[model samples]
Target: MLWYVLVAIVAILVGVVIGFFIARRYMMNYLKQNPPINEQMLRTMMMQMGQKPSQKKINQMMAQMNKQMK
Candidate 1:
């Protein structure tokens, strides 16, 4: 009766929490293995924008990007 309903609600809550954590972990690993951006892509983008890309600039951009992601 009421006990069965309580169990069902708890089970649903637990499942939701577990699913959220698992999905979060998977996404974190995926991002680490394959970052959203790379030096080549950044260079290409800068060139397209009419800015000559330099190594120093690239490194700075990468640092900023990583900081934001973290």
Candidate 2:
């Protein structure tokens, strides 16, 4: 009846909230363990673009990327 319908709606809402948090935590852990980019990848990309990759430049780019991520 109407009570069953109400319970179903509440259960669905709770499930959605829990699922969102679970997914968010998983993504944060995954990103921490496997960043989307790395120094080597940056070097290769710079080489493709014909820009000489230097340690200082690489470090600066990494810092900027990390700052943006936060």
Candidate 3:
């Protein structure tokens, strides 16, 4: 009975180690296939070429647009 218990414990440990390696490999492969986007790069690019408005300026512009629309 004691030998059986030890064998079972060893099998479980081996399974857990195998699972960890498999999960790591899968995650690495997924990231390699579909890399994450860098939003900051997009933001920086737009800033270099497009209009950059501030909160107060945007508010003022909105007020002016409302008056003009009316």
Candidate 4:
């Protein structure tokens, strides 16, 4: 009986760890394929805020955002 209980606990822990990694990897891939935001979206947001987003400025902001993500 003690052996069974121990085995069950070990299985549960291993499952939890594996599930966590699988979910994390799935989300990372999903986000990479469909990023939370993009250049066009950023440009629109800036324009809505009454800021004229030049291409250079947009590139800079995008680079900064990517840097922060890393």
Candidate 5:
């Protein structure tokens, strides 16, 4: 009975490790295949780098970026 329980525990642990690796691999591949970007995402990232961006400044920057993009 003790041996059976140990084997079950080991199996469960191995399964958990495999699942974690599979999920991480899938996520990494998916992200590499599809790199996402948008103005809002860039703004959020910039805000996180320092202070929160004001709406006025954000709007101004958005306009500038739009002009540049065009």
Candidate 6:
């Protein structure tokens, strides 16, 4: 009976680890295929805020955003 209980606990732990990895991979892939933001969206947002966004500034912002994600 003790052996059976130990095996059940081990199985449950392994399953949880595997599930975590699988879910993480899925989300990473999804994010890569569909990023949370794009240059056009960023430009629109800056315009709405009454700021004239230059290409260099936009690129800098994008770099900062990507760095934050990592």
Q: Which candidate model has the greater TM-score, 2 or 5?
A: 2
What candidate 3 gets wrong by more than 4 Å, as runs, is: 38-70
The residue pairs that clash in candidate 6, if any, are none
Best by lDDT: 1
TM-score of 1: 0.94
Q: Which clashing pairs does model 5 show?
A: none
Off by over 4 Å in 5: 38-70
Error of 4 at 35 (Å): 0.7
Stretches off by above 4 angstroms in model 6 are none
For model 2, how big is the CA root-mean-square deviation? 0.9
| Residue-wise C-alpha lDDT for candidate 6, range 1-70, written one tens digit per residue | 9999999999999999999999999998888788899999999999999999999999999999888866
Give the TM-score of each candidate: 0.94, 0.92, 0.55, 0.91, 0.53, 0.87
lDDT of 1 at 33: 85
Cα RMSD for candidates in order: 0.7, 0.9, 14.7, 1.0, 10.1, 1.2
* Pairs with backbone N, CA or C atoms under 3 Å apart (clashes), candidate 3: none
All models: lDDT?
0.96, 0.95, 0.68, 0.93, 0.77, 0.94
State the TM-score for model 2: 0.92
Full ranking by TM-score: 1, 2, 4, 6, 3, 5
Report the candidate with higher lDDT, 4 versus 5: 4
- Please identify which of the two predictions, 3 or 4, would achieve the higher TM-score against the true structure: 4
Query: Which stretch of 10 consecutive residues in model 6 shows the poorest summed lDDT?
Result: 61-70
Tens digits of per-residue lDDT for model 5 on 19-69? Answer: 999999998777656645456876797788996877777778767765664
Instruction: Give the Å error, residue 46, model 6.
Output: 0.8
Measured on C-alpha atoms, candidate 1 has an lDDT of 0.96
- TM-score, prediction 6: 0.87
Point to the candidate with the largest TM-score: 1
Give lDDT tens digits, candidate 4, residues 1-70. 9999999999999999999999999998887788788999999999999999999999999898878766
Better model by lDDT: candidate 1 vs candidate 4: 1
